[model samples]
Structure formats: structure tokens, C-alpha cells
Target: MCLKRGRTLLQYAISPAVWLGVWQLASMAVGMDLLLPSPMAVAASLWKLAGTPQFWLSALFTLGRVCQGVLGGVALGSALALLTHFTVWGERIFAPAIRVMRATPVVSFILLVYLWVDRATIPAVVAGLMVLPILWGNLTVGLESVDRQLLELARAYRFGRWKTLRLIYLPSLRTHFASGLLNAFGLAWKSGVAAEVICPPALAIGSRIQQAKVALETPELFAWTLVIVALSLGLEGILRRVVHPREERGQ
Candidate 1:
């Protein structure tokens, strides 16, 4: 098991090393930091930024906004799924609106929402909008796909509503909900950052990214982008661990 784990870690390391080597070669050939900063230069910029209080503050604010949006979206979407699944009137009233939301471009929502909301709030609102349709669609399907036999069995056993949900519905929807949540989180994080970039919130990673770009600080831009990527990966890893702790522990 140790040998296998070591090999897996080595494989992961090799892929990044190879990509970094290619990036370094390309940067050297270009010979212009403006067009493409070297990996080392970006790393140095990241180290510098990491020492600043503003960097941590911006990351914290962005993380808070994205997480708020994700949780709100999940709650709203789950409620909508339940409503639409259980009632024809709910389906008729909300389904078309959800479809329209799903069809609309994210940039459009961000722009429209920006006009309606304060700049600082736009990121969270836009992130929720982006996540809502995805979760709603995924969970609606999950509800539809619940095993009729299991539901009937629960009814046959005279299970209460709470018992039915706890034993039958939740277990059946677990995979679908988990998948939708992870996907929604990724979308929410990205959309929130994009909204922040467009609106330029007071203290956000996206704001810093925009500042770096406006100043033509290419290395700084790369560093901020690397920070975003790292944060996204780290948060997603945490979510996965929470969602599938048994799998993570090799159970």
C-alpha cells in the first residue's frame, strides 16, 4: 500500500514538473516577462504577496462570498426541486423561469445584477445565480430517479414522513446531491471571481487581479491567478473529503 501511494504521489509530481519545465522553456524563448513570466518569477511574486496582510484579507473576503453563494444556491435549489417535484402548480410557475435562467449567459446576469446591487454584493449574488440552475436541474432529476420500490416499501412499513426521508430518500439522493454540490461549488467560485473582476469589489482577490492587470504587472497577475487556482483546488479537495470521507480513508 505504501509503495502504491508513493507511486501515485510521484505520478502527480511528474505531471506538474513536466508542465512547469515546458512553461519555463517557453518563457525563456519569449524573453519578455510582459508576455509570459517564468515560473520562478511568478513564484517569487506569490511569495511576496503571501507576506502581505492585504492578500490574506482579499482571499478571506472572496472565500466568504463564494461559500455564502454556494450554500444559498444549494438551499434554494433543493427547496425548488422539492416544490416542483411535489406540485404541478409549482412546476408550472417556476420551471420556465428556471429554464430561462439556465439558458441566459452568466455575463448577462453579472452585468444586470451589477446594475441592481452594490458592487461588493455582486459577486455573491452572481455566484448564486450561476449555481441555482445547475443544482435545481440536477436535484430535480435526482428526485425523479428515486426508486419507486423503496418508496413503496417505506409506505408498506407505515414509515412516517421523517423516517421515509431519512432511510429512503436521502440515501438514494446522496450521490446526485454530492455531485451537484461539487459542480455547483466550482461554478460559484469562478462566477464570483468573474463578478468581482467586472465590478471591482473593495477587497477581493479578483480586485487585486484587476489591479495587477491594469498596472501591467504580468508576474503579479500570474501570481494572483496561481493563488486563485490553488484556492479553488484546496477548497474542492476539502469538499471532496467532506463528501466522501470513507473513500478518502480507503474504506
Candidate 2:
């Protein structure tokens, strides 16, 4: 078991190094920094960005947008799922809405929402819209799969509605809820960033990325890309740790 774990750790360490080596080679082959900045140049640019207040502010706001969208998606989607799960009218109403969201292009939603909301909030709105369908479907399935017998037992025991929900419904829905959370954050992050890129928020990683492209600051662009990747990975890692700390430690 120790040997297996050591091997896994070794692979994790070496894999990124190998990719970096390939990236360096590609950059060297390109021969023009403007076209493809070397890994070293990008690293330097990344260090430069870290010194700027704007960089931190952009990161903070971008993270806030993604988190806001994700939270909204979870709450709204769960409510819709419950409504649809328990009622014919809700099913009739929400089924078409979910289908529309699923079928519609993200860019269309972004553009339509742009007309309705300020540019600053578009990223969050787009992010929430993208994640809503997934959570709604997951929660609907979860609510459907919940054991009626457990609910009956809760009633027999004179469990209050809140207690029944906390003890029975939530426990039954955890797997599906966890599934939604695992995927929703990434979707929210991607959609949020895309919205920012299109709309160019005052403070955002996506705005920085677009600015870099416009100025042809290749190294800065690469550095910003790296930062975004790091942020995404960090958030996902933190969530995984929080959700499955025991499993992670055991492994």
C-alpha cells in the first residue's frame, strides 16, 4: 500500500514537470516571445502580476462571481427540483424551462442577460444559469429516489418537518447533492470567466486576459492563463478536501 501511494505521489510530481518541459521546448521552437512566451517568461510575468493590487482585486471579484453563481444555482435548482418532484403543475411548468436552458447556447443566454443586467453582474448570472440545469436534474432524481418508508418512519416518530428533512431527506439526497457540487463549481467558473471575457468587467481575470490579448502581451497572457488554471484547481481541491477529507487522508 505504501509503495502504491509513493508511486502515485511520484506520478503527480513528475507529470507537471514533464508538461512544463514540453511547453518550454515548444516555446523555444517558436523562437518569438510575442508568438509563444517561454515558461520562464510566463513565470516572471506571473511574479509581476502578484505585485499588483489590481491582480488581487480581479482574482477576488472573479472568485466572488463564481461562488455567488454556484450558491444561487444550488439553492434555485434544489427548490425547482422539489417543486417538480412533488407536483404535476410544477413538472409541467419547469420541465420546459429546464429543457430550454439545456438546449440554448450559453452565448445566447449571456447576450440576452446582458440586455437585462449590468455588465458587472453578467458573469455571475451566466455562471448560475449554466449550473442550474445540472443541479435541478440531479436533485430531481435524488428527490424521486428518496425512500418513502424512511419518511413514513419519521412521521411515525413524531419528527417535526424540519427534523424529517434534516434527518431523512437530506441524508437520502446527499449522493446526488454531492454530485451536483462536484461538477457545478467547474461549470460556474468556466461560464463566469467566459461571460467576463465577452463583457469585460471592471475587475476580472477574464478582463485581464482580454486586455493582454489586445496588447499582444504574450507572456502576461500566458501567466494570466496559468493563474486562472491554478485558481480553478485550488477551488476544486479545497472542495474535495472539505467533502472527502477522510478518504483523502486515507489514500
Candidate 3:
């Protein structure tokens, strides 16, 4: 077990070392900080940012936007899914809207939504809009895929709506729900960041990245990019911990 764990750790370390070596070589070859900063320069910039209160506040604001979008999107999407799943009229009304949301460009939404909301809130709103269609589609598929025989049996057994949902639909939704959330988090972050970049929020990672670009702070920009990547990976880790165990058991 110890050997296996050590090997796993070594593999993890080795890949990054290899990539960093390549990056350093490329940066050295370029010989311009403006174009491609070395790993050391980027790391130094990241350290400098880490020591600032501004960085923390920006991270916090972006984190809130991400959470707000993801949670609201999931709730709204699931509700719409339930409505559409149960009634033909519900499907008729919502299906086209959901499809439209999915098909629309994120930039288009950002431009249109900017007219309705302020810059600070636009990231959250855009993130939510990106998530809604994903959850709605997954849920629609999940609900529709539920066993009709089991549904019939539940009805014949005089099970009420709530009971039927609790027993049948919820269980059926497990995989789809987890899948939606895991996928939605990434979508939410990307859309949120894109909105921030376009709108330039007061305090956000995206705002920092945009400023870094405007200033031609390549190392700082790379460092900020790394921060976003790290956050995404961390969120994925948390979701995996929460969702994977249940999936394994279901299997």
C-alpha cells in the first residue's frame, strides 16, 4: 500500500516537473517576459498576489458569484424539469425556451443581459443562465428515462404524487443529477469569468485577469489563470468526493 501510494505521488509530481521544464525552456527561448514568462516569474507574481487583501476580496466575490449561479441554476432547472416531466402543457411551454437557452451564444447572452443587470451581478446571472439549460436537459432525460412499469405500479398501488416522486423519480434522477452538477460547475465558472472579463466587475478574478491583460502583465495573467485552474480543480475534487461514492454504491 505504501509503495502504491508513493508511486502515485511520484507520478503526479513527475508530470508537472516535465511540463514545467518544457515551459521554462520555451520561456527562455522567447527571452521576453511580455510574451511568455518563466514559471519562476509567474510563481513570484502569484506569491505577491497571495500576500494582498485585494486578492482575497476578489476571490471571495468570484466564489460567491460561482455559488450563486450554480445553486440557483440547479434549483430553477430542476423545478422546470419537474413541471415539464409531469404535464404536456408544461413541456410545451418550457421545452422551446430551454432549447433556446442551450443554443444561444454566451456572448450574446452577456450583451443582452448587460442591458438588464449591473456588472457586479452579471457574472452570477450569466453563470446561472449557462447552468440552467444543462440541468434542465439532464433532468428531462432522467425523468423521461424512469421505468414506466414502476410508475404504473406506483399509481396502481395508490401512491400519491409526492410518494411517487420520492420513491421513483428521485432515485432515477441520481445519476443525472450528479452529472448535471459536476458538469454545471465548470460551465458556471467559465460563463461567470467570461461575463466578468466582458463587464469588468469591481472585485473578481476575471477582473484581475482582464486588468493584467490590459497592463500587459503576462506573468500576472498566467498566475491568475493558474489560480482559476486551481479553483476549478478544487471544486471538481469536492464534487467528486460528494458524488462519486454514491455513484459507486449505485453501481
TM-score of 1: 0.95
lDDT of each: 0.92, 0.90, 0.93
Which regions in candidate 3 have their CA more than 4 angstroms from the true location? Answer: 246-251
Model 1: worst 10 consecutive residues (lDDT sum): 164-173
lDDT of 1 by residue, 169-202 (tens): 7887888888888898998999999999989999
What's the TM for model 2? Answer: 0.92
Where is model 2 more than 4 Å wrong at Cα?
1-9, 155-161
Give the C-alpha miss distance for residue 170 in model 3, angstroms. 0.1
Q: Name the runs in model 1 displaced over 4 angstroms.
A: 1-5
- Across 135-177, the per-residue lDDT of candidate 3 in tens digits comes to 9999999998999999999989999989999999999999999
lDDT of 2 by residue, 49-156 (tens): 999999999999999998998888888898898888779999999978897997888899889999999999999999988888989988888888889899889889
Q: Model 2 lDDT vs. the true structure? A: 0.90
Query: Can you give the TM-score per candidate against the true fold?
Result: 0.95, 0.92, 0.96
